[model samples]
Each structure stands twice: as structure tokens, then as C-alpha cells.
Target: MDLKSTVASIVDWPIEGVIFRDLTTLMKNPEALRESCDIFYERYKDKNIDKVVGIDARGFVFGAVLAYKLGVGFIPVRKKGKLPADTIEESYSLEYGSGTLEMHKDSLDVGDKVVIVDDLIATGGTAGATVNLVKKLGAEIVECAFLIELPDLKGRERLNGCKMFAMMEFDGE
Candidate 1:
């Protein structure tokens, strides 16, 4: 399936000059969603993942299911204060300013192998921050996975030394 076509392109979304690749369209299609999940599952089944840490919002959609399929725990890395329990926070740079993400302090055990998941990798800022949070908690970051990647942005540069995977790529903005 052409997952890109399933994604709806919204011009000037969230801000001018920004094109948002909305996954809600793709997620609504049963076959596309299933295939996408299956691809991730098949690719990482042998990676010895102890936990799947999903970024807030979109990541939750596939992360939970992927964790379940892998028979591993699903941990959530949410926006500031979104998690009710005691949390550890990491603030990182954004295009305009800074944003904060949080995860429960007890989400992962020391030396646990964790995989971070998100819907897209545009600039890699959020993914990098999530990795830092995982490190701070003493977990081993096995890899970072995404459904789409904006190659022209060079987001992968920020993730040096980290294993990164994306199902689809788009070069042009």
C-alpha cells in the first residue's frame, strides 16, 4: 500500500509554510493501518525490545498495538504534566522556541531496552529529547522508529549514534 497517498496533506497547517502530513486519513483505512503495524512488527520482532515508548498524541495510536503484538510493555512519553504520576521531564529546542516532554519516573527499569515511536520525524528534535529522557532513566535505547520521514530536513543528523527507522520518506516540502 502507498501509505503516503493515504496521508492527507494539509497546506500551511499549524503555521504558514508548513505542510502537515496528517495520519488520521491513513489510520482510518483498515488495510493501511494494519499493514503499517505489521511492517513495524515484522522488522523489530527479533530486536529484543523490553518496552515500546511512544511519544505523545499520534504515537500512541500504533505504539500500544505494536507493544502488545511484541508482548512487551508500552510506555508513554507525553507532553508536560500529561502523565498523572511522578514524572521526569526533558525540555528541548523547537523551530520557534522550546517544548517539554515527560515520562513517568518508573516507566522503565535500568538497562531495559526501549524503542521510541512517533508518527513522523520532521526535525528530530522531539525524538532526540525522548532519547535523552530514556538515557536519564538509565534505559538502553535500542532504536527510534517513525512512519514517515522528511529527508530534506536532515532530521537524522540530530540522532547520531542512534538506530533510526522510517517506513516512508519524502524529499520535497
Candidate 2:
């Protein structure tokens, strides 16, 4: 299936000259949702991922399922103050503004293998911040995965050379 077609695009959302790639359309479709999960599962099933760290909100949707399918732990990288525990935070810049992400300090152990997951990668601020949090905890990142990528935004450059994968690309649109 062409997963890119499953996404809904909203123009000038949250600001002018910004296009939001909404995955809700894809999630609502049973076949699309299953296929999306299956794609990630097939790729990482044997990769020895000790944990699947999901970015706040959207990332949780696919990350939890992948963690279960791989039989590993699911760690949530939440927005600041959302996690009710001792947490570490990393701040990042967005197209319109700035925000912070937090994760529990005990979410991972030193040398644990991890794969970060998110719904989309635009400017990569969220993904990059999440990467820092993972590194601070001393977990080895296997790769960062996403459902959609906007290559035109050059988000990949912010990842500090960590390996990345996206199910589909919607670039130069």
C-alpha cells in the first residue's frame, strides 16, 4: 500500500505557510493502521531493540504497538511536566515556536538498544530532542523511525547523524 496517500494534509495549520501532515486518517483505517504497524514490525523484529521510545502523543500510537510486537519495553518521551516522576528534559525549536520534551530518568538502562518513533519529521526538533534524552540516559540508539517525512524541511540534518527511517516521504509539496 502507498502509505503516503493515507495521510491528510492541512495547509497553513497552526500558522501561515505550514502544512500539517495528519496521520489520523491513516490510523482510522484498519488496513492502513495494520499495514503501518506491520511495516515497522517486519523491519525491527530481529534487530534486538531493547526498547521502543515513543515521542509524546502521536509517537505513542505506533511505538506501543511496535514494542509489543517486538516484545520489548515501551518508553514514552512526553512533553514537559506530563510525566509524573523524576524526569530529564531537552528543549527544542519548532517552526512557529519552541517546546520541551521529557522522559523518566529510569526509563532505560545504560547500553540498552533503542529505536525512537514518531508520526512525522518536519524540522526534526522533536526527534532531535528525544535523541538527546536517550543519549543522556546512556541508551544506544538503533535508529529513529517515523511514519512520514518532509524532506524539504531538512529535518534529517538535526538528528546528529543517527540512523533514521520513514515509511513514506512527502517532500517539496
Best candidate per TM-score, number?
2
Candidate 1 Cα outliers beyond 4 Å, as residue runs = none
**Residue pairs in clash, model 1:** none
Write model 2 residue lDDT over 44-97, tens digit each, in one string. Answer: 998999999999899999999999999999999998989999999999997778
- Model 2: CA > 4 A from native: none
Q: lDDT at 113 for candidate 2?
A: 98
Error of 1 at 162 (Å): 0.8
Q: How does candidate 1 score on lDDT?
A: 0.88
Give me the candidate number with maximum lDDT: 2
- Indicate the worst ten consecutive residues by lDDT in candidate 1: 90-99
